[model samples]
Target chain A: MQKHFITLLFTLSLTGLNFANAYEMETTFHGVLDLRATVTDSLTGNYTQGGYGKFALNDGESFTLAQAGGEIALNWDNGLSVHAVANAYKNNGDFKLGLTEGYIKYSGLPNASGYRWQSKLGVFYPKISLENNAYAWASKNTLNSSSLNTWIGEEIRVLGNEITLTRLGRINKDPFDLSLTVSAFVNNDPAGSMLSWHGWTISNRQTLYTEKIQLPYFKARMQGYDLYEQASSSDPFLEVDDRVGGHVRAEIKFHKKGAISAGYYNNNGKPYIVDNGQYAWKTRFTHIDLTWLLPQGIVLTSQLLHGDTLMQSPLKTDVVNNDYTNGYIALSKRIKAHRITSRIERFNVKDNDKTVGDNNTERGKAFTLNYTYRLSKPWFLSTEFTWIDSYRPGRMYTNQPINLTERQLAFAARYFY
Target chain B: MFNKLPIQIKFLFISFFIIFAPSFVANATNTLTVNVVDTNQKPLENMVVYVEPIGHKVTLKNTNTLEIGQANKAFIPYISVMQLGSKVKFNNQDNITHHIYSPVGDNKFSVKIRSGQEVIKNDFNEAGEVSMGCNIHDWMSGYMLIVDTPFFAKSDKNGNTEMVIDKSGQYKVVVWHPQMTDINNRITKTINLNSAMAVTMQLSKPMDEIPSQQNEDDFDFLSDY
Candidate 1:
C-alpha cells in the first residue's frame, strides 16, 4: 500500500509537469544558495532536537545550510505558464529532496476596460504573506520571519485551485488598482495542529515536504505521552476528512505607493475523522496587511492576524479550541544597494479547552534588526539580531519556568541567480 | 607655416583654393557641427540634433521604412529620429511578448508584439516627439523624434554630431532629449552656415536622474509573485 501511494504521488506531479509543457514554452532558470552561521541563548538549558530545534535554534552554536533551492519558470506565448521550486538540504538532521511549490497558471489579456483574469492549479502556498512573496518564499527584510509566517511555512500548503481577477489601473491611467482572489484547497486538514502543539516560534527554516517533525517537550508533558511521535509526521497536504477548504482575498493599491489587503481562510475539517494517527483540525483565520512606500526609499509595513483552531475527540463529545492573535510592524530603508530593516512583533494564544489535559496558552514579544549589503550582482550579505520574550503556562510540565527569554544573532551569505 | 611662407605665396594659395573648391563639388556643401551638454558640462548621449532653415524650405531625405528591435526587455537604440511621413516597424526579438505603447504624442499607439512575430509598422504623419513605453515592463522606455527637415543627426556618446548640408544658409539649431524639461525652448541659436562651424548648447536645467536598477513596478504580487 505504501508503494502504491508513492506511485500515485509521482503520477500526479508528472501530470502537472506535462500539462505545463503543452504550450509554446520559454523557460527562465533561477536559484539561490544561502548559508548562515547562528548563535543563540535560551532560558531552557536543555537544547531541543530535530525539527523543533531547527526552527527555535535554541541549541549549540552551529553553521548550517539555511536554504538552497532552484526554480524554473516556463512562460508561453499563449499566456500559459508553469513555476516550480525544489530544495535539497538537511531538515532536522535528515537529508531530503523536496518540492516546495508547483503550479500551472493561465493568464488572460486585459479587456477593453483594462480588466484581467488568471487561474492557477496544483500545490502552492497562499498569498497572505506579504513578506515571504519573493523567490523560494524568502523574506525580503530580515533573516528570520515573523512567528506567524514561521508557522505558515512549517504547516500550510494548498493543493487545489485558485483564481484571480484584477483591474489594471495603471493602464487606464487610474491612481488605484483593485484585485480579488478566491481559492479552494484540500489536503490541509493538519494545518493548525502544529501551531497548537508547538505554540509560536521564530526561525527561518522551511519544513521539507516529506520530513517528520518533532513537537516541543511541552506536548508530551501536558498530554502524558508523545502524541505526535509517529513514524511519519502529519501530512499538511493530506485530505483526511475529504473536505474542501477555501479562502478569499481582496486588495487595493492607492496612489501606486500604498496597498491595503484583507483575507479570510477556513478549512472546514471534521475533527471526528482521523487517519494514520492524524486528526482533522477545523481552523480559520482573518488577516489584514497594509504597506506604504514613503518617499526617500522608506517602506512601512504592518500586518494583523487572528485565528482559531478546534479539534474534537474520537467520540465527538469533547472539543479543544485554541485562539491566537498576531501582529507586527516593520520598516525598511533602501539607500543604493544597502537595506536596513527593523520590526516589532507580538502574539498571544489562549487555550479554552479545559476538557483536555494539554493547554497551549502562550504569549510572546519580539524585536529584530537587520542589515543587508549587496556585495555584487549575485551575492548578498546580511546580518540580523533578534530578541524574544515568551511566557508559556505549559512549561511547568517540563519543570521549567513559564517565562523565557531568547536572543539570536545570525549572519548569512547568499548567492542568487 | 603660412606666416613663414612668402606673403605673395599665401595670397596665391588662398585665392586658388576658394575658386577651385566649389568647382570640385556638385553643390556648395557646409558641415554643421553641434555639441550638447548638461548645465554641468557633461557629455550627453541620445540627444537629437537637427537644423531647420529659417527662411527656406528643406526637403527630408529619408522616405524609407525604419526598424527598432526589442530585446532584453529594452528598446535597442533608445532614441530614434525620423522624418515626417516616414514609417517605422517594431520588431520583437526576445522570447516574450512586449506591449509597446505611448501615452501622449501626436502618433499615439499601443500594440502587443510576440516573440518571432512579424513586425508591426506605423507611419508618423505628424511632427513631434513620441515617448514610448512597454506596458508589461515599466522601465523599458524609448523616444522618437519626428522632424520635417533632412539635416538631422543624433549626438554620439561624446555629445558631438556633424550633419553635412547641400547648401549653406541661415538655419536654426535645435536639440531634444528625453529628459528635456521644455521642448519649445530647445532651439538654441540661429547661424548662417557659410563654413564648417562648431556650436555648443548648454541646457537650461539639469537632466533627469538616471534610472535605478530596481524598478518600482517590480515585486508586484500579480506578476513577480
Candidate 2:
C-alpha cells in the first residue's frame, strides 16, 4: 500500500510541521515482554530433525513448546530511534508470529573522523554470527549455526528491507561495518515450482538484497527468487506464473570474527507442499554455508547443505536430481554465568534417481553436550547431552533397510526479568 | 630548538607545568559519562552494567579492567564484573586442555588450564555472580560478576547505560542476573544521583536464553536440574 500511504504522509507531515498552539513531540520508550518453554525427545529423530536441538536433546524424552514475545520502543532526544520484536509459538502442531524489528533508526549521522552512521528499516537479524543477533535466551545453540542454514538462510533467517553503512573504529581503531540491501518477501521460490504462496501471486514473492559499494572490511550479499503457481494437472505446458526461478547468495566478513557464506538454490517446484506418499508432492533445493571465529570464544560453525525434491518437471521435460547433504562444525562459549557447549553434526540425503528405499539415501550423525550456571540475582542452571546416528538403505520399493539410534538428556532452570 | 630555549626559558617551562600540577599534592580529579537504554528506547548492545563505589575509596588506575578466556568448553567473557578486591586473569585460548574450577564461593578459585596457558592471581572480594565449569570441559561455562559499587556500565550496541555515582543514596536499584530466580536478588529503584542522565535496561529476556552455539544440554526437559 505504498508503504502504508507513505507512512500516513510522514505522520501527517509531523502534524503539519508543528500545528499552531499545542506542542507535540516528546519521546522515550523501553522494551521486553518475553516468555518461553521448550521440551523435546527424539533418540533417533523425527519431525525433520535439522534441529529442535537435534532429535529432542535425549536422555529422558519430550517435545514441548510454550512461548510468548515482545519488544516495542521509540526514543528520540535527537539521535532518533525505533525498536521491535514480536514472537509467538506452538509446535507439536505448528504456529508462529511475525517480525522481530520493523526498522527506522538513526545515530544522528553527521560526523567524519569521529565516525558513525547508522540507519535501519523493516525486518532485522543478520550480520552473521555471535549467534547473529542472539536472544533465544542469549543462545548457546538452540541449534541454528548449521553453516548459515545451508547457504545464507536455512535459519540465519530473513525478513526484508535493509540498509546499513557504518565505520566506527577505535579500540585503538578497528571497527568497520557496511550493509546494502533490497528485500521483499513471501519466499521459498523453489525455482517457480510454486507449492506455497497463495497470497495472490508475485511469483512466490522474493526480491533479495546486498549489493553496493563495500569497503574497509569488504561485504556482499545477493538473494534471488522466483515463483509461479497455477495448475490444472502436473503438467500442461507448466503454468507457473510466466516461468520464474530464484536463488543466489554470497556473504563475507573478514578477520575480526571471520565469516564466509555462500548460497545457490534452484528449486524448480514447491507450492505449499503436501504429499509425503514417498517423498514430495514437492522438494527442490540446494544450500551451503561456513564460518569461523575462535580466539578464545570458540565459534567454528560449518555447513555444506544440499537439498533436492523433485517428483516431476525438470521444466516440462527431461528431469532427474534429488540430493541433500548437510554439514556441521560449531563451537560456542558465551561468557558470564558459566556455559560449556559442544557439537558435531552431519546429515546426508539421497535419491540421485533412485537405487533403494523411497528412491534411496539418508544419513544422520549428531552429538552434543552443554552446561550452564549463572547465579547472582536469580540462579540459572542448565545441562544437556545428545547423540544420534541414522541411516537408510535398501528396497528400491521393498528390501527394507533402515536403522535409527538416539540418546538424549536435558535440564533447564530460569527466572529472568 | 636552538631558536627558542631563551625566551625566559620558554616562559619558565610553560609556566612551571601549567602552574604546578595541582600544587603537586593537593590532588583533585573528576570524570563521568554514562549512557544506556532499554524498555523500548533501545540502544543497549553488550549490556553488563554495574555500580557500587560508595565508601571503599579510590583504588583503580585502570589496567584495561579485566577479561579472561578458555574457548568452546566454556569461559570467554560471558560476564565479568569487578572491583571489591579485583584481580582475575585466566587464559587458555583453547587448543584443548582445560580443567578449570571454582569449587566454593566468596572467592574460591581453582585451576588447570593447558594450551598456551595463563592464570593470574585471583582475588575477588565478593559481591556475587561467580561460576565456572569444566570437569574436562563438560561443556565449559563461565561467569564472574563480583562488584562492590563505585558505579558500573555495560550496555552498548543500542541498549544504553551510564553510571558515576560517587556518593548517591538509596543504593538498592537492582537488576543482576545469572538467570535470576534469586541470588540475593534485587529490583528496587530510586536513583536520584544528581543526573547527567542515563539509565535503561531493555531486555525482554536475555540472561542466557540459550542460542549462541547450540547444544543446550541435549534433553531432560527440566523437571529438575
DockQ: which candidate is best? 1
Q: What is the lDDT of residue A118 in candidate 1?
A: 85
Docking class of 1: incorrect
List runs of model 2 lying over 4 Å from the truth.
A1-150, A153-184, A187-307, A311-321, A331-351, A354-417, B1-225
Clashes per model (N, Cα, C within 3 A) = 1, 99
Off by over 4 Å in 1: A1-23, A43-54, A91-93, A218-232, A254-256, B1-214, B217-223
TM-score for every candidate vs. truth?
Answer: 0.71, 0.23
Would you list the C-alpha lDDT of every candidate in the order shown?
Answer: 0.73, 0.41
Worst 10 residues of 1 chain A by lDDT: A45-54
* lDDT of predicted model 2: 0.41
